[model samples]
Target: MSVPETPSTSRYEISENPEGGITLNIHGNMGAANAGQMIDELTALLSDYSPSSLTVDLEKVDYLDDFGTLVLAHLRKLVTNGGNGFYVINSSDKIKELLSILHFDSLDEKMSIEKKRSSGIFIRIGEATLQHISDLKYAISFIGSIILSLVHICLHPRSLRTDDTIRYMQRVGVDGLPIVALISFLMGLIMAFMSSVQLEQFGANIYVASLVSLAMTRELGPIMTAIIVAGRSGSAFAAEIGTMKISEEVDALFTMGFNPVMFLVVPKLVAAAVMVPILTLFSDLFAIMGGLVVGVFMLDLTAGAYMSQTIKTLELFDVFWGVLKGGVFGVLITWIGCFRGFQVRGGAASVGQATTSAVVSSIFLIIMCDSVFSVILRYWG
Candidate 1:
């Protein structure tokens, strides 16, 4: 079987060799524009004749770019995989040099992944351990920087950016009030209703106020506000700074001789620390009101009695302790959010990952810190 010769205008010629193989005589200027046509013609001839072996002659291919090289490389793979011998002959130094640069001749075999590999349990554990250690070191370093910035501001009040701090305070605190109040109120109502059912069986329904008051002021109010802020403000911080980092704005700050920590992070930190406590106080008040609603309606307690019981049950220390927890949690949330943001190294997808990490880390740290406070207060109080 034989193939027709190429016309004068054609850049490639196909012919059949009597020795049971086909020869492709490629000519000048193979590039992106004509590479597709070359491949199609070669494919058609290969399919019609079904050559046992194929050889591509490239002596006349004066200029070969990456695209043309890639097309030819694919042809080689197709011939070899179909149980036929494939050979390239008569190439100049320029073509060879370009092929070598791209490693086009061996691209498929190098890139082929026949099967996915899974790591052993121990190997995965080791990798995870190392990653966490690196992350922990980063977190510590970030915390140190924040503390240093705070100290510097304290020593030189004029250096602090008060305007940014106030803006963030309004955003992180005032903007978040509605949701915080709603969640806290619902939490208190549920707690009171659940406890009232049990307390009523014991004919101690009035103690419902005591339970709601103590739980909200000592634990729920601070923790709920912190979690809300983590989801709201912490994630926002990470996303904002991560976007700036990816867009090279953070680098521009460095070029302008601005400390990013002092300029960007300190205001957020101060605002969060200052406002979280105030939000917690609001949360506590709203939660108590929710419990009062339950006590008056569900528990059949008079309004005055519920108020009297709540007041007697809650101590100044309990309220102050919750507010203190709020302040500490505020620091954790803001620091983790900013730290994750600064850790962003790549493009838009990295910013997304950093935002998620910030929210998750802040929530985790808040719960852990609350646990520690619970343990210490158990012993101290």
Candidate 2:
């Protein structure tokens, strides 16, 4: 079988061999100019022809280049893919040298691509277990490092980054104030309106103020403020540190004999711990004002009556307890945020994952800690 010759390129003549295989005899130049056309014609001809073995006879009077080598590689792949043997023979020393330089034999090995198989459920579970264990170990270490950093800061107050702390305070507390106040006020209004509906039936409408004030001061105020801060400031801390981590800035800090935790984490921690409690106080105030609005308008109670009831119901201990919870939640948020940031690996995608993880972990910790506090407070009372 003869392939129709193209002008100024190689052509192939396939001849039956004594071994019941086939020999492809090529003639003319086999360079880039002819490579594309040569491969197409060869592929079309060989599509219908399969043999036990195929031999490429390249003894033709011509030159060969990388593109020509690629054509031969393609033919080898086609034959081998059909579970047939492919061989190259009768090349000049120059052609042989070029083939050797290109490591043409490696092409056959490369042609067989290996596919990855998915692991079984047990294997996946085991991998996840190991990963979690590693993460937990890292978390413990990070916590210890943070404690040490705090101690160092206590010893050398001058080392604290006052400017960064103040900036974070503005970001975490002041910037967050409007939204926190709005949410708290709405929460209080809803609570008062709902409670008044039940209390009005029994002539106990004034007790609505007591419910709003006590709930806001003792529970809702600190928890709600912490959640808002987690969504805003916690994610910001993670993203900032994650970016720095991926950019090698964290490593640079270590190389310069600076503790990354002290330099980066401590300021944010201080800012959050100080400001979140203050924010909680504001949240409680707004929530009471919202309740007062509901009481005066909906319940037909005077502002003085509402305020007097609220003050009578809330104790100094209740306010202090909420502020203390706020401070604890702030520390948890900053810790988790910075921890997730330090855990980031790879690139921009890892930073995004870290940011998301930080917010979720912070919120979970906040709720868990709040539950523990509830148990403690219940028993203490």
Candidate 3:
């Protein structure tokens, strides 16, 4: 093949081959004379295509001195700084040898990149998991303290902080009513509507009331309310407690001989235990009411008939089961929230992260616990 010789010594011919990207078939020795010139020319070539990546082939080149190395490194930096990608292929033996010496060989470089990326992901996930478990552990410890305090209070009823506990009850229970009402009512309405649509086709539309009431009262109402509370109150409690923890207020409480569990945690737990059942009752009532509305509108069934059907299908066990589930959910929400709060030991961001983790972790545990309860009851019954 005839060599296509160019007039300009500084600038080299660049053929964009579809088979390979940026094939730079080097002819002569790459040195000081060629280096600066190539850099200027290559810089211009880069401004045009702006490819996702650039591949510089050195297979045709007979030799590459140190100056050539400088140019290649500079090119790489340029592409990266311009927010474009870069790659190298068809390295000559000399280039490969130099790369090996400089610790930039392809095999090692690729392996290093992979290791860094994988380790980063693994580290992030591991950190999240550890943090969650740590928060859970703190929550369990707090509960243990609360249990001890409760035993103490039981023994010395006169020393009980009745007034503070009462106030906590008001906050956790009464204040949470509106949100619980709306969500539970909506869930019931949705269940009723969907059930009525299908059951009406089978001429079983009257059964919609039973379906809505039984499902909500037995399973959905308490679980949904608990999950919501975990999201709302659990996070708030964590943040509040976390802030106090990071600020060393918890230490101060200990120094002053006041039990942090009694001062902060027990109130929330007791309040939640009481409030959850109340909310569950409200949820069951709202859901039934919602089903009743659907009955009147869609099924043309009288409220009396719908209520009668619901009563016939509903069992006392179902009501007790729902309340029991709500109690478990309540314990979970309070435990998770208080635990997350006590686990806080950093800045505001840490508190925020702990709060979010508490909510997510609490919800997961509640569902799992509820599922376990259901399975056991089914087998027991």
Candidate 4:
């Protein structure tokens, strides 16, 4: 049987061979313009006749492009998939070279794609352990660098970046004041109101001022301030240094005979250490005022009596302890932030990850340190 050409740019004649296989004689251009229609028509013919084998004669074809190569590949795949032989013949040297270049011979073979197997649990555990060890080594090295930098600055006071330290102080302290104040005030108000509910039942409403003052001066003040600073300044420190790290600015500093740690980290560390305690002191004061507001209005206590109770309840040691904790938390925050920044690799995405890690690590360390302090205080008191 002979098949006539359709409106497609490519034409092909299918004839049943005497040997019981079908021969496809292709004519005209076998380029992208007719590749789709050619594949569809050829596929339908092959399916209808269910030929035992297919022989594609490319001798009459005028031109063949990559898309045409695809049409040939498609037919080869279909025939082979149906357990029949697919053969290409009667090609000019040009067509033969084109097919060879396109690796048309390999088109009939199935591709082997190896899928990766999941690692065993023990292998994952080993990897995690090694990663933690590597991180610990880096942490120790960074801490040592920080200490050496501090000593160098101490020995040569003028070597310190006084201007940068001042700038960071303003950024960490002054800029953070409003939010710190608002949060501390609200915290104090809530504490006072809650304590008043219980104390009022026992006619101990006056103790609300004492409870608010003691908590703010000893515990809540430093912890709350540190958390806020971690979220704001800690993330900023990581992002700033991480960007510098990825841009090779840190390397540039090292090449210029500058200690990257001293140049970049020291100023931030000093600023945070100096300013955080001051911020905590302010936090305590604002919280006291919030409690006073609650005491005077809700508890119907005179402002003078509330102030007296607060003053009488709080010792100077309590204020000093909170400030001390704030200073420690400040150092931890800046150190972790700068360390995470230095750990950054690759591009902008790494910087964002570093910033997030810095905040989370700082907060975790702060709470952990606070717990230790609580244990020590319990024993000491």
TM-score of each predicted structure versus truth: 0.74, 0.75, 0.65, 0.80
Candidate 3 lDDT tens digits, 58-117: 665555656677677767776666666566668866677787676553322343333444
Task: Give the alpha carbon lDDT tens digit for every residue of 101-196 in model 1.
Answer: 998757877856668788999999999999999988998988888889889999999888999999999999999999999999999899999998
Q: State the TM-score for model 4.
A: 0.80
Model 2 local distance difference test score: 0.92
lDDT of each: 0.89, 0.92, 0.78, 0.92
- Per TM-score, the best of the predicted structures is 4
Q: How accurate is candidate 4 locally (lDDT)?
A: 0.92
Model 2 clash pairs? none
| Full ranking by TM-score | 4, 2, 1, 3
Which ranges in model 3 have alpha carbons more than 4 Å from their true place?
A: 1-140
Clashes of each: 0, 0, 0, 0
RMSD of each: 6.7, 6.2, 12.8, 5.6
Candidate 2: regions farther than 4 A off? 1-109, 112-127
Query: Model 2, range 1-381, lDDT digits (tens) per residue?
Result: 122244476678999887768899999878767888999999998877777788999998377888789989999888887788889999999889989999999866775668898899999999999999999999999999999999998999999999999999999999999999999999999999899989999999999999999999889999999999999999999999999998999999999999999999999999999999999999999999999999999899999999998889989999999999999999999999999999999999999999999999999999999999999999997
| Stretches > 4 Å off in candidate 4 | 1-49, 53-74, 83-104, 107-118, 347-349
lDDT of 2 at 123: 100
